[model samples]
Target: VRTVVDLGGVTFMDSSGLGAIIATYRSAQDSNGWIRIAAPTEPVLRVMQIIGLDTIIDCYPSSEQALNAAEQ
Candidate 1:
């Protein structure tokens, strides 16, 4: 269950949104799967970086890159 979330059009996100992602990430890990986030806006990216989400999950500049990484 490899997932790649596209955030190219997302401008804002709150704790609930972050929680959803974290939940999915945990689920993926539990299933021997993975998740990636792509094209996050500056604000969202900053929040993720501040909270170290980027360290735990892979983030890419584009969905294509994310999917490519998932392939490898």
Candidate 2:
């Protein structure tokens, strides 16, 4: 199983979003699933990078890429 998160058009994110993503990732890992983020805006990407999520989550240049990666 796989989950793709879309961050496009998201100009800002708070701890809630971060926590949600973290929880989702953990859940996926527990279930032997993969998770990815797609097309995050610059600001969102920066936040993810700063929080070390960029290294943890599979990030793609576009949603299609993410979806394809997940499918694979």
Residue 65's C-alpha lDDT in candidate 1?
99
Q: How accurate is candidate 1 locally (lDDT)?
A: 0.94
Clash pairs (backbone) in predicted model 1: none
Counted clashes in each candidate structure: 0, 0
Question: Model 2, stretches more than 4 Å misplaced?
Answer: none
- Name the top TM-score candidate: 1
Distance from true location, Cα of 30 in model 2, Å: 0.3
Q: Model 1 compared with the native: what TM-score? A: 0.97
TM-score of each: 0.97, 0.93
For lDDT, the strongest prediction is 1
Candidate 1 residue spans exceeding 4 A from truth: none
lDDT of 2 by residue, 1-72 (tens): 478888888999989999999999999999999889999999999999999999999899999999887776
